[model samples]
Target: MALLELEGVTRRFGALVALDQVAMAVEEGEVRAVIGPNGAGKTTLFNVITGTVKPSAGTIRFAGESIGGQPSHHVCRLGLSRTFQITALFPEMSARENARLAAQARHARRWQPFGGAGVFRQAAALADAALEQLGLTSIGDTPAGLLSHGDQRLLEVAMAMAQQPRVLLLDEPTQGLSVEETAQAVDTLARFLQASRMTVLLVEHDMEVVFRLAHRITVLHRGAVIADSTPDAVKADPAVQDAYLGGFA
Candidate 1:
């Protein structure tokens, strides 16, 4: 079975339809990129899959279990984790601390009055590992708010990775980054993904990043899928060209 599947999913904000009967499947170990112009429902799709927003209709299954409309925290515990388009972090907390909290969330006993020392130790190890993977080990002690914008973006990703999710959802992971920073982040992420082979569903505006990391591309336009195929195929798709990739391809 596919690791993540969405069938006939729809979401509406009042009278405005944000997503319309969307359907797609992401296989285990696959890196799928969801791309589109602004207002095309890419973010809405992520919100729905992550359980941040309840779908107005249709079903979402992850690892063969229905997840549609489940709470975000519940979905996260089921092995789905995501980073937001806007960098979400505890600005006052050190990078390591931020990651550690995410790691702790995965532990069943994390909310206990006295979770054993072992739980804390494991969470710490995972946090440090995620920071190292993102090349942020040197700045692990820096406050997230004090870090550069690029560093904050990478830190958010590290925090999500610390959750050790089976399916990672990244929403514009490289937003607001310089060309150099973007390249560095992409290279680090690429290396980590190669080593982990984690399943990923990405929503990104940067076509370069999308093409480089995605095994398959699913294009959206006006709240519906316009094209879903290999990167090259999607790029060449006539509908995609007219609707979204007019000049990017």
Candidate 2:
């Protein structure tokens, strides 16, 4: 069964029809990229899946169970997590502290903030592991606000990883990064996903990052899917070429 499925999903903001009968299926352990022009409802799709917005119609299923309209926290508890287009981090806290917070939140069912030394130790270990995996051990003690933008982005990923989510939704992970930084972030992400085997659905505008990391691409236009295929097929698709990739040349 597909790990995450959206069938005939639609969301309308009063007079605005943001998404229309969208259907998508993400297989387990695959990196699926969602791409579109600015107003194509890519962010809306992520919001709906992550339970930040309820779908006006249709069903969303993860692991074959309906999850549409569930609360955001509930959705997150089900092993679904996301990072935003803007960097989301505790600026005043160190990178390791930010990660530790996420780890504690994830294991809160067993965590006691003021109760035991062992719980804090476990959370710290998880955060350390996540930082090491992202190659951020050197800056683990640096304040997030002091880190470079690219490092801030990586720290966000580390926080998400500390959640240990089975399905990760990354929205514009490389946005605002320099060319060199973008390349580095792409490499780190590809390696991390491969090592963890986490199912990923990312919304990205950078065609290079999308083509480099995604096993399949789903193109959205006017809040609807215009193309869904392998990277090569998507690049060759006339419709995708006209609507989205025309500028790539």
Q: TM-score of each candidate?
A: 0.95, 0.95
lDDT of 1 by residue, 143-203 (tens): 9999988889889889989998999999998999999989988888888788889899999
Stretches of candidate 2 off by over 4 Å are 110-116, 247-249
RMSD of 2: 1.6
**Among these predicted structures, which one has the highest lDDT?**
1
Worst 10 residues of 2 by lDDT: 109-118
List, residue by residue over 1-249, the lDDT tens digit for candidate 2.
Answer: 899999999999998989999999999999999999999999999999999999999999999889999998888888898899998899999999999988888777756655677778888998999898888999999999999888888888888888888898999999999999888888988888878888999999999889888999999999899999999999998899899899473
Clashing pairs in 1: none
List the global CA lDDT of all models: 0.91, 0.91
Q: In every candidate, how many clashes are there?
A: 0, 0
